[model samples]
Target: MSRLARLGLAVTLLFALAAPVRAQVKDDTPRNYGVGRVATPGQIAGWDIDVRPDGRGAPPGRGSVKDGEKVYLDKCAACHGEFGESAGRWPQLAQGKGTLASHDPVKTVGSYFPYLSSVFDYIRRSMPFGDAESLSNDELYAVTAYVLNLNDIVDDKFVLSKETWSRVKMPNQGGFFDDDREKTEKAFWNSNPCMKDCREPVKITGHAQAVDVTPDEKTQKRGVE
Candidate 1:
């Protein structure tokens, strides 16, 4: 071979020989990052506040509906209103029963939520809006109980605890059902979906401007001016 051809072959051979060495170095590199230590049991417990539908993760506490009313008035009344009827644009928590079938369905704690555990979990984790997780265990139970009372799910004399949580039946509990689409729709499902030319060429059917949802340039300019 000529000198130029021989030099090119040598350069190629050099790279081919070094590839295995580079792979070996990468293989010998340590896998352990050695940055974060294993979290302590106490640390894990602090963050493990998620309550299951079966009431598995709920903490031990009890609060009477009467006591819950006081707690609700102090912490929740400003936003949810004194009787859970809502204040201004805030959500209405109680008395939305039989409204789900209406044109404008009122989806509240009583009318739509399926599980009582969900209410407890939400209030315990995040409630009182700006001041979240500030309620004590007793206060948390009380507030939740009071909300249940407002919804007429539980009586005024009822005390909410982990034991009594199962007894508190929400009105719309029967409205929800487990998703069985996997089993039910398996026969209808297409295993291999079409990737190309799935339908006819695109056509402009309509514009969003026709719906008047989007503000026109003139309206935006007027607001700015």
Candidate 2:
């Protein structure tokens, strides 16, 4: 056999021999590191606080726009103005109905967000600037409803809960669609990449010396390219 063929056969034999050893070692090693216990249902519940668009995982709670306004004024008004107009550099949460297509579009809770669940999830996960996950379930629901009321999306009497969450439709709900780039942009894709001589041979059109960008050869250090 050729020297390269002999080397290849040796490598294959070595790998074949090591395969059983590797499998044995893997089987002998403990899969569990013995560091932490499996999470309790209560612990899992705490971490699984995400609210979905379809109202799945929503906590059983209710909050009225009026109650939300009170909570908003006390907890949220310092940053998001008295009526969700936004204070200083903070985000504006209301009054940008027809401004989306304009040059300076004010993307607030109402004008830009495609889902109410997203708003609820954001507030539930992180809100009041610093004290994240501090609000009660009712407060979270109320504050969310209040934001909707600020945008005129909900009436002052509207009470938001798991029951009514599905009834509320966001203004930009129809703006979002599933990603179809694979289907739409597949025609322009180049799967096979060229590595060698893929284009016309590159010719030296000019040199750095022609543009006077190169240092003087006399000043260049010896043995340096």
Candidate 3:
């Protein structure tokens, strides 16, 4: 071999041998990345407030529809109508049966929400608009019951609690489905991963535009304010 070829081969061999030495070096100096202190149990509990779809993690409380109605009117009626039919630009909380596929879908608790625990979780954490997390546990239960009553799912006398939560099911309860991507789509992905050949560059196609669909800037700023 020529002198240039020999020098190139020697450098490549040195790199191939040095890679293992670098890999074997132990990084035992203890990286002190000052990434905040360890959180306390109480601090963790305050932020860890996620409720399950199966009625788990719900706080204990009871509230009657009668009380719920009062609470709804006093606190929720201003935005949500007297019967949960959103006022003005506010979102409608009830009604809208069988309108999911239509051009104008009116998603409400009665028509869209899948889980009842979601209602409890949402209201308890982010309800009464500006004054979120201000309502007591019992008051939140009442609010939930009242909303259910508006949808005619529960009677005016129904008293909702964490235990009886599972009993309250939305109309479109089974409308959803579990994703079967692993079984149905995994084969498509694993079947053909290699691309050995090239194709001609495709021409640009007509693009679609979404006009008059977005909310105005003013309305966006005052969201549920």
- What is the C-alpha lDDT profile of model 2 across 1-225, one tens digit per residue? 999999999999999988765443346655776898889999999899898999998998999998999999999999989988999999899888889889999989889898999999999998977999999999999999999999989998999999999889899888777999999988778888778889897899978777996677898678956
Ranking by lDDT: 2, 1, 3
- Candidate 3: the clashing residue pairs are none
Model 1, stretches more than 4 Å misplaced?
1-35, 178-225
Candidate 1 lDDT over residue span 99-202, tens digit each: 89999899889999889888989998889798888999899999899999999888889999999988988788789778999998887788888899999999
Which model scores highest in lDDT? 2
- Report the lDDT tens digits of candidate 3 across residue range 26-115: 778999989899999989887776688887787778999999988999999999999899899998999898899899889999998888
Tell me model 2's lDDT, rounded to 2 decimals: 0.90
Structural similarity to truth (TM-score) of each candidate: 0.70, 0.66, 0.65
lDDT of each: 0.89, 0.90, 0.86
For model 2, name the residue pairs that clash: none
> Cα deviation of 109 in candidate 1 (Å)?
1.1
Stretches of candidate 3 off by over 4 Å are 1-38, 179-225
Q: How well does candidate 2 match the true structure in TM-score terms? A: 0.66
RMSD of each: 7.1, 12.9, 10.1
